[model samples]
Target: MTPESARALAEDYFNGGRPHPLDIGVYTFDAGYVAWPREPTPGDPTVLPDTVGGACIVIDRHTGEVSVRPLLPPELVAELWPDPTPR
Candidate 1:
């Protein structure tokens, strides 16, 4: 999604008259689903080309976009927030 749309989506979190005293930037998550091919067992009852749980969401920062699968790993979280330590 565009930056304007992203900004608008994030604005909801800014409500309640509570001051968000930080320079944290806003990100957009365009939702979608993704899957990869995989070999199946000979006698397996499950279907081939296993599908992942939970849909993907595009994290757009205007500069670029990255897809986040379920259970975002620490490395990705680090990329999202360089400074992880709470103030």
Candidate 2:
């Protein structure tokens, strides 16, 4: 994610401040399986190396906006936010 997007997510959640640096994202490839606790899991961003759900991301608390793209060019994201990050 871009620095700006990360900052936005941090401000939206985590008490309008920086998200805990250690709090990496949690997601899974097996969306079909029901999780007992419906939240980010311990095997976050590390379990499924071949799946994007295991990838790192920052999400806006209210909007649920997610950024998988890094601070680089990708045609789709660039269209939405012309300049995603502050170089």
lDDT of 1: 0.37
Q: lDDT tens digits, residues 57-81, model 1? A: 3344544344444334324443444
lDDT, candidate 2, at 25:
30
When summed lDDT is taken over every stretch of 10 residues in candidate 2, the lowest stretch is 29-38
How do all models score by TM-score? 0.25, 0.21
Best by lDDT: 1
lDDT of each: 0.37, 0.35
| Model 1 CA lDDT for position 78 | 35
Please report the TM-score between candidate 1 and the true structure.
0.25
